[model samples]
Structures are given as C-alpha cells and as structure tokens.
Target: MDKIKVLSIFGTRPEAIKMAPVVRAMQQDDRFLPITVVTGQHREMLDQVLKIFKIVPEYDLNVMGKGQTLSTITNKVIIGLDTILENEQPNLVLVHGDTTTTFAAALSAFYHQIAIGHVEAGLRTWNKYSPFPEEMNRQMVDDLTDFYFAPTSQSAENLRKENHASEKITVTGNTAIDALKMTVQDDYQNPELNEIFDKGNKVVLVTMHRRENQGEPMQRVFRAVRKVIDQHEGVEVVFPVHLNPKIQEMAQKELGNDSRIHLIKPLDVIDFHNAIARSYFVMTDSGGVQEEAPALNKPVLVLRDTTERPEGITAGTLKLVGTEPQDVTNAMIELLENQSIYKKMASAKNPYGDGDASLKILDEIAKSIKR
Candidate 1:
C-alpha cells in the first residue's frame, strides 16, 4: 500500500494541542506522511506547543503582527497556503477546530480541489458572533470539509442541524485528550510551580485572556477571585496572564501584591499543561481548558456566562458558573468545602474522548480519498 500524504494546519495553542496527537499518530503510522503548518496567528504561544510536540512545521506563514484585523489574517493565510498547497499537494488537508487558520487553509485547499478533514469538528454555539469569528470560522470550514471528526455526539448533531451531510461526519472524540499523553510529563519542574506548592496551598490554575472578557467583566472576575482566595487561607491562584495590554494592566492592578495570587506571564503549552495537571481546580474564560480539564479530573469554573462546550457540563465534568462575582465566589466555595460535589465533578467520565481521536480521523480521511 502506498503512503497517503496529509497536511495538518493550525495556528493557536488549542489547535496545536489537539492537532499534535493526530500528527504524531500519522508520523508513526507507515500508512501516512504528515506535513505540519503553523500560521503564526498566535506566534509565541503556537511555537511553544509545536516545540512541546517536537513538531517542526514545513511552512510558517508568520502572519502575526500589531493591530492585525480579521480580514488581514484571513487574507494572509489564504495567500500563504496558495503557494504551499500548490507545491506540496497532499492526499488530504487536516485542520483542527475553529480558527482563522482552520477556515483559511480549508478555503485554499477547496480552491485547489483537495479533500479536507476537520478535527474537533461540529462544535457550535450557533450564534455567529458569540465567539467573534471562531464560530463563523468553524462553520465556514465545515462547509468546505469533506470529512468531519466531531468530538461528541452533540457536536455531530450540531453539524446535522446545520444541514451538513451525515455520510462525511465521524463522531470521534476530541484529540486534546490524546495530547495529554505527551504533554503531562512525570518530571516537569518550574520555580513558580514550586513556590505555589511550597506554601501548602491548593493551587487554582487561572487563565482569562479572551477578547470578550477584556474590560469591566474581567475586572469584576479578578476582584471576585482575589476576594475568594483571600478568604480561603490555604488557597493560592497561579494566573498565567495573557500578553494583551488590557489583561496585563487589569491583572497587575487588581491581583498583584496579593500573597495568595501569583500573576505571571503567559505560559508555554508544556508549562500550562503541567500546571493544569498539578492544580486542584481551574478557572478560565478560554474554550480549550473546558475540554482539557475533564481528562485531568479537575473541575473547571468557566468565567464566561455561556460556553459552546455544554457537553462537558452535561456530563458532570464541568460547571457553567458564569462571570458574576457572587456566582463565581459561590462555585469556588462549594468546590473547596463540598468534597462530594468536587469529587463528582472531577471523577465524571470525559465526554470528549477516550483518546484515539486522531486514529479515527485518519481512518475517515483514508475512507474519503479511497476509490
């Protein structure tokens, strides 16, 4: 049997984490040749995941820059991929989730009449602008996709609801669960991590860098977290603050100088994954962590009022305790004091996947291009 060439493209940290497992699986399997491409939409953070995965992308668009708009990113990726895809025409183009890169690469491939496999597909909030471009990106990508690797039955249903073809969709679990295998190392070490554990305090891994939670909402959440940590003597917060100036300013002003709260710079994929593994629980406004935390058996208190990932909450692995200070504080308190509720959240089955999502995705790709 001849080897099938697969080009896997992604830009952000979450996309890389989920896609890494699929790429690694392909690299090991003699049946396929994997080509990885990083769009550099999220330069430093994206590179961190690639390094952790030991993946050197065959092409890098390096599209990140100051004041880059959605139009610019979409256009740049389309242009960059035009050349790459023309030269390295693969049997299949695999993209992960909803990102500018995911949509743009799929567009380029479709223009060239190449088949596309969407990993972590069928995720939807339905509201186009709720996630601000991500929702649209995934939807557009799905329209172009010949194969869909839906993470959950719910996600697969979402695709069906949108009138996507049933024959192309595969309900393969999320690949992020598979990524945990490589990232959560036994001998991971960091000075800040040590300082966190040294205080005999339970660490709450915090990450809130979303554009939606930027101004007042973010401040309110930070204030609530500070109050909660202050009230709990044996609790500490380790927040890897995002590089966004607004986030940095707010975090430094509100959470800085607090003994229990440690506001550090943005973490690389390895550091962030290891930190999540060590934490007692997680609080975040990000999408990926909501899915990732369940596998680590950690409770995630979503900072947003709503989430596209309702499956986690439905499965008892997550709680949608929105951005309201009172609600946030109450949720945190319950998790700390109520061991039964905490364990229930932690020990619930991971609805995302049992791993092996990448293999299922590959199988679908093989089926799509076969005959």
Candidate 2:
C-alpha cells in the first residue's frame, strides 16, 4: 500500500501552534508521509512556535516584508506554493484556522486541483470585518476545503448553515488543546515569572493584538486593566506585547510605566503555555488563548466584543467583557474579589478538546484517503 502524502502549510504563530500537533501526529504515523511548509508571514513569532514544536519545515517561503498588505501576502503564498505543489503533488493539503496563509494555501491547493483539509474550520463572526481578514479568510477557505475539521459542534453547525456537507465535517475538538498538553510543564522556569511568583502576586497573562481592538478599544481595555491592578494589592499583569508599531505605541502609552504591569517581548509557545499555567487567569483578545486557557483551568475575560469561539462562553470558562472599561473592570474585580465566581469559572470543563484532536484528525484523514 502506498503511503498517503499530506502537505501541511502555515505561516503565522496561531496557525503554527494549532497545526503543530497534527503535523507531529503525521510524523509518528506510518500510514502517511507529512510535508511541512512555512510561509514565514509572521517571521520571528512563527519561528518561535516552530522551534518550540521542533517542526523543521521542508520549505520556507520567507514572505514577510515591511508594510506588506493582505493582497501581497495572498499573492506571495499562492505563487510560492505553485511550483512546490507542481513538484511534490501531495494527496491532500492541510491548513489551519484563518489567516492569509490559510486562505492562500487553500487557494493554491484549489489551483493545483489538490484536496484541501481545513483545521479549526467553520468559525464565523459572519460580520466579515469584525476580526478583519481572519473572519473572511476562514469563510473563504471553508468554501475551498474538502474536509472541515471543526473544533466544536457550534463550528460544525456554522458550516452546515453555510451549506457545507455534514459528512465532510468532523468535530474533532481543538488541536490547541493538544498543543497545551505538550507545552505546559510542571517544572517550567522563566526568570521574570519566577520573580513575580517570589513576590506572591497573582498573575494575569494578557495578549491583545486584534485589528478591531487597535486604537480606542485597546486603550480602553488597557485603562481598565490598570485600574483593576491599582485597586488590587497583590496582582500583576504579564503582557507579551505584539510587534505591531501602533499596538506597541498604544500599550506603552496606556499600560507602561506601571511596576505591576510587566510589558515584555512576545513569548515563544513553551513560554506562553507555561505562563498561562502559572497565571491566576487570562485576559485577551486572541482566539487561540480562549481555547488554550480553558484547558489550563483558568478563567478568561475575552477582550473582544464578539467571539467565534462561543463554546468556552457556554461552558462558563470564558466571559465576554468586550473592550468597555466598566465591563472589563467589573469582570476583573469579580474574578479577583469573588472567590466562588472565580472557582466556578476556573473549574468549568474545557469545551475545546481532551488533547487527542491530532490523533482523531489523523485517523479521519487515513480513513478518508483509504476509502
């Protein structure tokens, strides 16, 4: 029996984090040959995740540049994958979540007439521009995808409403949970974090980098966080600031110069997972963190007004505080001051997955290709 050749492509940190488990699973399974490609859309951050996962890609497009637009990323990925697809000709191409890389890779696979499997598919804010390119990217990729690996039943239902074939969609939970299983360690050490722990301060890990929350929204949320920290005596914030210039400026302006708020460089996957594991709770606008934090048994205060991952909210692990200062302050106070509320949110079951999504995804792929 000939081995099924599977090509997995991703460029950004979020996509890389979610897809790593699936790629690693393919590497261990004898039934398939896995080919890895990185578009390098997010360069440094993407490299950080790849190193943490120990994923050495067979190809790197190096597509990142100063002031690159979405159109540029899409075109670069499509053109870069063109020759590779023509040469390797994998049986299927797997893309994760929504990014320019996800859409462009799916587009490239479609151009080559290759089957495409989308991981973390069917997520919808339906508003299209709510999350900027991501919401649209996932929607369009789903149109081109042959297999839809929906993380939750809600996601699968979204696909169904959009007229996607039910049989082609698999609710394999989230691979982010699988990643969390590999990343968080009992003996994980970080000097900065150690200093915070030594002070007996409760840490709140934060990651806010959504296009929608850029200027005013980000500033509002930052102020709310600062207010909460000021009111509480033994609480600290560890924010791994995004590299975007506008964001950097806003973060420094709103949250900087505060001893309690540690504005640090972006973290690698291992450091991030360990940080989450050590934190009291998380507050973020990141989609991956919504799923990952819950699995770590931490309550999450979603900084966005809307979320595609509603499973966490329904499961009581996540609370949508949006970017309103009052709401954000209230949510933070409840988590900090109300022990019962904190326990209820912290102890809620994680709806993402049980950390076997990669195995289930591989099994489904094998079964599909064999048939």
Candidate 3:
C-alpha cells in the first residue's frame, strides 16, 4: 500500500509544543508521509519550540505582521496554504488546538476537499467570548473536522454533545503530556531557580497573558501576587513575562523592583517544563500549563474566570481564582498556609494523559484511512 500523506500545521508556541510529538511520530512511522507547515503567528516564540523539538517545516508562511489581528492571521493562513494544498494534495490535514491558524488551515483543507483531523479537539467553556477568539475558534474548527482527537473523555463527551459523529472521535489523551516526557529532565538546571529550590523557598511559577486579562486585570493580579510575596518570608515568584509591549509595561510597573519577584524573559519549553517540575506550585491563565503542571505533581491556580480544561478542576489539580485581587490573594495565602490542601492538590491524579498520546493518535489515524 502507498504511504498515507499527512500535512500538519501550527503557528504559536503552545500549539507547536503539543503538535510536535504527533508530527515526530508521523515522521518516524513508515506508513505516513508527514509534511510540516508553520504560519509564524507568533514568530519568535514559535521558532523557539520548533528548534527545541527539532522540527523543520516544509513551508514557513512568515505571515506575522505588526499588530496583526485575527482577520489578518486567518486570511494569511488560508491564502498561504492554497498553492501548497494544490501542489502536495495530502490525504489529511492535521491542526492542533484553537489558534486562528488551526481554524484557518482546517477551513482551507475543507475548501480543497481534503480530510481534516483536529488534535486536542472538543474543549469548551460555553462562554464563547471569555477566552475571546479561542473558544469560538475551536468550536468552529470542530464543525470542519473529519476526525476529532479529543485529549480526554470529557472533551470527547463535549464533541458528542455538539452532535459530532462519535465514530469519528477518539480519546487520545493530551499530546502536551507526551512532549513533557521528552523535555523535562532529572538533571535540568537553572542557576537562579537552582538556588531558590536549594534554599527550600516556596516557588510560584507564573505565566499569564491572555487578551481578556490585559490592562487592569493583569495589573491587579500582579499586585496581588506581589503582596503575597511580601507577606511570606520564603515565598518567591518566577514570572516569565510575555513580550507584549503593554504586558511588559504592566509587569514592570506592578511587579518590578521586587526582591522576591523575579520577572525574566520567556523560557524555552525545556526550561519551562523543568521549572514547573521543580516549583512548589503554579499560577497562570494559560491552558497548556494546567495540564503540564499536574503531570509534574504541581498544583495550579488558574487566573481566568472560565476554563475549557475543567477536568483539572474536577481532579483537584487546579483552582480557578480569576482576577479579583482578594480572590488571588486568598488563593496564594491558602497555598502557602494550608499544607494539607497543597499536598492534596499536588498528589492528585493527572487526568490529561499517560504520555503515549502520540502513538495512540497515529494508530487511530491509520485505521481511519484504511477503512
């Protein structure tokens, strides 16, 4: 039989990290011709993950522009893939998560009459605008999807609730867990984090940069964390600040010049994973980190009011504290003062995956094509 041709596309750092394992699995298998394409939606951040995972795409859209909008990204990805889809004509086009790139690529593949597979499918908050475009992006992509690689049973149920064909959905766990098996190392070291961890300081690993949480929300969150750092003697924060100019300004104004708060450049995937592994707990508005932290036996405090990854909350691995200053302050203090609560959250079972998601995704894909 001829090899199955699979075209995989992604554009942001989180999408690149989660999709890398599946792409690499397809590359190693003899039954598939795997092609990679990156839209450069988040150029520098995306490049860092690609280099870490050693994935060199066949096409680089290089579509990032100054202050790019959702429409611009959508337009660029669709137009960029038109000639490539016409040229290669892969049997399946695979996209990950809810980025504008994922939605646009799936739409383009639909336009070309090609089968589309969506990885990390069927996640929902039901509040479309809470996560801004992401909630709606994934919902729309599921409509265009021919195969749904739902990361958990909860997500699979979500797809079914929307009347997506159950036969087309597979609960493959999360590919982010698969990436952690490759990146997080026992011997990983960072000088600053090393000393902090060595001294037995309670480290709060933080990453919060969503469009809805910018400006006042971001400012208040920072202030709350800073106040917590002051209240506790050995508690310190390791915040890898996002490079957005407004965020940079807010982080500086609210979180800077603090002895206990370490505001640094964004970390690469490997460093980020290891940091999570070593930290006491995490506080973030990012989705991927919710899964990644629980895998490392670290508890998470989600900064958003709504989360599509509700499995974490149900499993006792996450707390949704939102952006209220008092709520944020109380959550931090509880984690600091309540050892039983911290231990319980830390020891809860990770509901995401067991780190073989890449292989499971590939097996389902092959079976679907053969049928």
Per-residue lDDT of candidate 2, residues 236-299 (tens digit)? 9999999999999999998999999999999889988988888999999999999999999999
- Record all residue pairs in model 3 with backbone atoms less than 3 Å apart, i.e. clashing: none
In the range 208-314, model 1's lDDT, one tens digit per residue, is: 98777789888889999999988989899999989888789999999999888888888887788888988999999888999889998999999887778989989
* Decreasing TM-score order of the candidates: 3, 2, 1
Worst 10 residues of 1 by lDDT: 362-371
Error of 2 at 107 (Å): 0.8
The prediction achieving the highest lDDT against the true structure is 3
- The RMSD of every model to the true structure, in order and in angstroms, is 1.4, 1.1, 0.9
For lDDT, candidate 1 versus 3, the one ahead is: 3
lDDT of each: 0.87, 0.93, 0.95
Ranked by lDDT, the better of candidates 2 and 3 is 3
Error of 3 at 295 (Å): 0.5
Regions of candidate 1 where Cα sits further than 4 Å from its true position: none
Model 3, 116-185: lDDT tens per residue?
9999999999998979899999999999999999999999999999999999999999999999999999
Q: Which stretches of candidate 3 lie over 4 Å from their true place?
A: none
